[model samples]
Target: MTRALLSAALLLLLLPGAPAQVSSQTSFTIVVSNSVTNAGNKTFSTFVSFRGILLGGMRRLQDKDSGFTFKYTEDDNYGPFLESVNGLAGCPNHRTYWELKVKKPDNKVILPDVGIGCYIPSAGDVVILNFNKY
Candidate 1:
């Protein structure tokens, strides 16, 4: 009976139904810039829980920094679409939109294929919200 119990315990340990691993929170930075107007960039510090989306960190930053604010619209197909930041709204008529980019700690910059609601930021990543005309 003891051997059977041990086998059962070992099976449970090797099972795929085990709880998912949890990770600690990670810190990153966010930079807001306007290439269309040449406005200076505003940098803010924020953190995200393990595997948390960028929108969560942005919401946290907005809550902590009075100077930081943002708004988004929910799309039935594409999830949340960023609409405005710091009173500057992206105008479709003007061909202006907020571009999402990320700079890693090693200085490699990349444009994520996903939007803010889906992108999972890593530690020391610099997320850039650039306003530009496309």
Candidate 2:
């Protein structure tokens, strides 16, 4: 009985999709858009470690793609506030800011009630950053 139990444990360890064999790398897409619909849009493919923050994935993309760049300011109360994407900066006088939205694998759109620093992106999630006026 002990030999049979040991064989079962070995089989479990060799099977695909076992907890120990799970992948730590996850792939997601980032889309940048303008609410005004005139600035044009861009999409980037990025990946992060399991349960990693969206901001880290964004930084990874920026490092890989020269055309992609972003800037943010730390908020004491709110964490990181997205200030600019590409070369466009949000202007208070213009009443503009960047908005975070996501399209999940289910095709449903969601607005996370949190900042970039707090968002944990899932595999296959399509994160959209839109520059819009308040």
Candidate 3:
């Protein structure tokens, strides 16, 4: 091969765009439950872009899963506050609200300090929407 051709090939190999990798979406599950009682329990399968936020996956679930539905309000201080799931709204008067939890592939559960808008889910993660008091 010509010297110029070889140099061009090496440059192509060094270029970031020359070896484009497809970013596949990640699959995970969301489990909705009533922590105060056994009123509602359901699971939904959904996906999000690699590095996407949890709220994006929840929106995708609502679009694709008929059994899953949720509502949120923008909190100037907290971003997105989960208000309800499956037609059940949290009432401040009753001290009931939705809590965000996550179960990793290793079966360890974590309570994220941030709401859905800020939380990002990993592959095989099980996000729990727990309806609880306080």
Best by TM-score: 1
The model with the greatest lDDT is 1
Model 1 lDDT tens row, 1-134: 99999999999889889567777898999999999989899999999999899999999999999999999999999999999999999999999999999999999999999999999999999999999999
**Better TM-score candidate (1, 2):** 1
Overall lDDT per candidate, in order of appearance: 0.96, 0.91, 0.90
Candidate no. 3 TM-score? 0.81
- What TM-score would you give candidate 2 relative to the actual structure? 0.81
- How well is each residue in 11-99 modelled by candidate 2, as lDDT tens digits? 97898873445468889999999996567789999988888799999999999999889999999999999999998889999899899
Tens-place lDDT digits, model 3, residues 25-96: 989999999988877679888988877899999998898887889999998887988999999899989999
How far does residue 40 in candidate 2 sit from its true spot (Å)?
A: 2.1
Name every residue pair that clashes in candidate 3. Answer: none
Ranking by lDDT: 1, 2, 3
Point out the higher-scoring one by lDDT: 1 or 2. Answer: 1
Evaluate model 1: give its lDDT: 0.96
Q: List the residue pairs that clash in candidate 2.
A: none
Q: Which residue pairs does candidate 1 place in steric collision?
A: none
